[model samples]
Target: MSYKWLKFFIMWLPVIVVGLWEYVRHVFLLPFISMELGNFLAPALVFLITLTLTRGLFAKLEQMQEALQRERLSKASFQQREQLARELHDGISQSLFLLSVKLDRLEHTELNDEARETTEQIRKTVKHVYEDVRQSIANLQSPAVVVDDSWLNAIHSAASDLLQNSGVHVQLDWQLPEGVLTNKQMVELQAIIREALMNVRKYAQATEVQVICHQLDDDGNFDCEIRDNGVGAESSEIEAKDRYGIRMMKDRAEQMDWSFYITSAKGEGTRIRIMSGGDKNE
Candidate 1:
């Protein structure tokens, strides 16, 4: 019923018919022109040919199986990302935006100097949180357009959108070698860059941002670096919060089988880098 079985049957049919014809000639004909050595070699040669053909077919089948497995994993990951994006946009992100607005109103109320300063701080913190939420949502959502050959273009587009929306000045330096990525790989890489840029817009109030994309080691691997000039984290404790933005970024990197690194200090600014070397064929 299956193509594999059909192919197997077809491959053996020639040997089967040849053997049957030889048997009829030996049994019914008066003089058989078949030598005993030829008779022995005929089956052996058929067996060797069948083995070779089947081995090649099996190898092709294994490749097909691997491709199917990758497709299934990709589909599952995409669905999960989509669901999380919706939840963040409609549930968490909207709530944070509303909370920021409320905090702003509270900050304007008459209060003592200390109280006003505290209120302003709260407002600023909430606004930052809101931005983080929106960025997280964007990172989880699928790209605005279907990705084709140019993953670098998708990364650039996502970075530009984040900078424009957040009013961050960005400098892009991209040098991606041609044909380094397939369509699927490009999609996943685009998602990683999107998350990285979102983190930049939310946490890095940096006046200037730099993004670098290039091939690594001629191994068909690519890496991205996003640096911001804003004040960085004061301590590791500052990033220890159970927040969605950083968590999503890490999750995306893991899903793509990529390596991600973040570096920051109190006044030194922040840098986020992602590298995908092993799983380039995804």
Candidate 2:
């Protein structure tokens, strides 16, 4: 039998036994005692015991429900990480490899100054793509841990890493409430933030960027914003044709049932935000 059913049977057994004892005392034992107090005391004892057992059963059920939820979330996270790994390997990694080969061939040919500079740019772009591909693979392989630190730390770390490596400056002003996030949510949030930072590095070309993360008053609702001050929309339209980072970020947010918004104006900047109704207690 399932543990829930077994626990129910165990908890109910005491009530059943107590009820029988009370009935016997009132119907038979009370006559021997010849006291109305025995009848009252017997039923009172039964009631107390039954109440305790019922509370225990309810507590056990609550614990079981929490455990099941955590298990389901863990399984889902593992599956998603696996799928991301496969997609990165099959799609981005393969494309980067082909691009590298093309760049190598171009380098071997003789070219004018302009063509040579163009080849160099292509090589740099290919190198950046390769690095991103490697990082995505690494993130997929890394195990997620729940820590008692600020969520902003994770966001800052990702942003800093991207900026330091890609020569982009990210300005962040975020205030988060004192609450923990689940492991799955953290992983999802981390991936989403990383993707946004990558887009800034790859396409934004803005000198400065800003990030914000905060909780809303409603239960389970939270929001994050990432904005950059760079050569914006017009350049972005020309750049978006080859950029998959934004699309991947949106896809990851959608997978977690979150809302994503992005806006940009030419010569102005780009801004991206994600909103979700996700539990914040890890």
Candidate 3:
């Protein structure tokens, strides 16, 4: 039965049983039973019937209600995913297509050495943009937000996929509490971390990479940092070589109103930190 029907029946069961008992007592049982005794038995009988029927019915009702709640949540998640996928397809995907066309036209006309180098750089940037957009669209279409630790798993999966054969020893130091980030925040952070790790895999040449996530304070603030002990670049070189990926990460953090910082020196290493505040438990 439906939860509503089961609930209604449970609610009115006592009244229904009592009414029937009273009618029977007045019509027939009056010869053998006193009015006071029937009145006393009526309550006991109602209580017994309610206790017998409602126990299993209440349990079933609870299960049905929980199932309904889960179904609603699933539909909401699906709707959110569809909206995001549509936005990405209409905005970034279309822009990338136009940029790719322009890059192809630019590739056809090769002249001076410097201009050729710049064109090549633009081509690389376009390639990265296309790849990133495709990844974002895929993530939107099939998000793994059902489990509480799905975001963490995604971070680990990204790290594994990128650095598996690169001889980089990656470490994940995840210490954030469960349900600390909203779905949007989690998606943003996952993308940022994946990008940071991809940068490390491509350019860092470091033997050790650390991905750390931790709570900053009691006010629901947290920090996520990606550090690598590799041949770090100078500020100018960082801007030139990894600008596209870095810019994308920065834009993501900015969209969420989070603080993003990058620290890299000649030989020390590189560290990218993203910090955000407020309770994002959703």
What's the true lDDT of residue 113 in model 1?
94
Instruction: State the number of backbone clashes in model 2.
Output: 1
lDDT of 1 by residue, 1-282 (tens): 455775966567667857875776578742745577557756776776677667777777887787677567667766888988888888888887788778778767878999988887887777777766665666566443233433556666776786678878778887776667655666656666676676666667777888888888777788888888888886563468754656667677788778877778988998877888744332
Off by over 4 Å in 2: 1-34, 53-57, 79-95, 98-106, 109-125, 145-153, 166-188, 205-208, 235-239, 252-259, 276-282
Clashing pairs in 1: 206-230
lDDT of 2: 0.74
Q: After superposition, how far is residue 195 of candidate 3 from its true place, in Å?
A: 1.3
Q: lDDT tens string, model 2, 1-282?
A: 455765776667767877787778778886577567775676677677777666777787887888788667766766787889999999989998998898889888989999999899988888987887888797675544343253457667777777787777877776555544566667777778878787787777877788888887647577889888877776457347566777788778888888877777888888888888744221
Q: Candidate 2: which pairs clash? A: 206-230
Which ten residues in a row are the worst by lDDT in model 2?
142-151
Return the candidate ranking by TM-score, descending.
Answer: 2, 3, 1
Give TM per candidate: 0.57, 0.63, 0.58
State each model's CA lDDT, in order: 0.71, 0.74, 0.81
Q: Which stretches of candidate 1 lie over 4 Å from their true place?
A: 1-34, 104-117, 143-156, 162-195, 199-282
- Each candidate's number of clashing pairs is 1, 1, 0
